[model samples]
Target: MTEEEPRLSAREMIERLDSSLSPGRRVRAVAALLAGLAGAVFVAALWWTEPGPLPGRTHLAFALFTVFCLAWSGYGGWLLTRRVPLFATDRVIAAWIGLAASLTTTTVLAVVAAQRDTGLGGTLLVGGLFAGMALVLAVRARTRRAALLRRVRELTGQEDR
Candidate 1:
């Protein structure tokens, strides 16, 4: 086995490769775009699924949950396919995403707990798990972003920049 050469940055690494992005790359990108659309459609399709009638509030809660999920998914897909660089680095953006997911999950779970006949312990347990994971992710993201910025400063010799 051989170790790959280290490049300064991802862009540099891509430039150094100088290979065609044929076959899977474009297909994969388009697929990614379509996947988001498909996800929204799939979520929307749930409305059509039926075994029997649902209580109005129960159905409304589920609908709100679905909308929130779709919006988050759509935002994620946009981030993935966006050509222009965002103001924040990927890790920072990821931290924001972690926050969004955590808030959404906690809220949705709480709504479900209130609307449905689910056990309190189970709902709290799952909601806690989601919150805990989000906390860990946010902490890790901050650490990584700081490290990355430090490295960039060291490499460029521009500490104040």
Candidate 2:
């Protein structure tokens, strides 16, 4: 492992230098891209095709939903086009963003259900599932980021409390 001695074989070096994502990540990227794009388009179409003018709150809700879907599409497209792997910091940020989106969407849905005198229980149940998943992802992402930071500190011999 000395500087004078080669550490990686030719194939290993080439693989490390390759820019493409792994198969699983590629699948995720494509799924995210398609799902987000479809969701955005559907929401936008519904909003546009409504027969009557909506209230200010309804308009805002539609806009928010559209933006959320667009954000996901943009993130997927960015990941697909990037040359480098997503780093720990990026993952942490993404996880937090997801958590926020989940919470916001859940709250909005719950409010709408209550206002419409619909099945609030069903709405909360579904929204809670998504929010819980997002929370789990956020926690996992933070843990992973911390572990990576600790490993880097160990390798550099610069441990800090």
Candidate 3:
């Protein structure tokens, strides 16, 4: 008689499926968390410590910037707390969120530069760089997710849709 292989428990199966955390990823996450938190605090401090009264629009801009940084920090915190891996899905979401924030901040900064008769070209150039980087990250995340999905399908002997 042929012997059947032992079945794995749910926890064992999950452990096998989930990828281990890499040092690079851990550093990136922690860096993001620290940078975001620091940026938020710095912006808030600037807004509070301004000597003269600022315009209402300026206040709104500062608030928006602070919130953006907070959002990034919150995302980092969430990533750190995730014990169950969502594969590259979390990365895809993070990239999209980063893209949105980059676009918004870039536009705001460009507008401010133009209003202040500063270097609009330089601002746009830097902003474009950041936006491009975010786009690249999003694309990479999506590609990774797709590849993982394909691997899973192949392993399961399922037909690709």
- Provide the overall lDDT of each model, using Cα atoms, as 2-decimal numbers: 0.61, 0.80, 0.85
Q: Which digits, one per residue and each the tens of the lDDT, describe model 2 over residues 77-150?
A: 87789885344655676677688888888898899899999999999999999999989989999999888767
TM-score of 2: 0.76
lDDT of 3 at 87: 66
Judging by lDDT against the true structure, name the best candidate.
Answer: 3
Worst 10 residues of 2 by lDDT: 9-18
Off by over 4 Å in 3: 1-15, 18-20, 157-161
Better of 1 and 2 by lDDT: 2
Tens-digit lDDT string for candidate 1 (37-87): 676677667766845897786577557656655655555565556554332
Q: For residues 36-105, what per-residue lDDT tens digits would candidate 3 score against the true structure?
A: 8999999999999998989886897899889888987887787777776666887997899889888888
Candidate 1, pairs of clashing residues: none
List candidate 2 segments past 4 Å from native: 1-4, 7-19, 158-161
Model 3: lowest-lDDT 10 consecutive positions: 11-20
User: Candidate 2 local accuracy as lDDT?
Assistant: 0.80
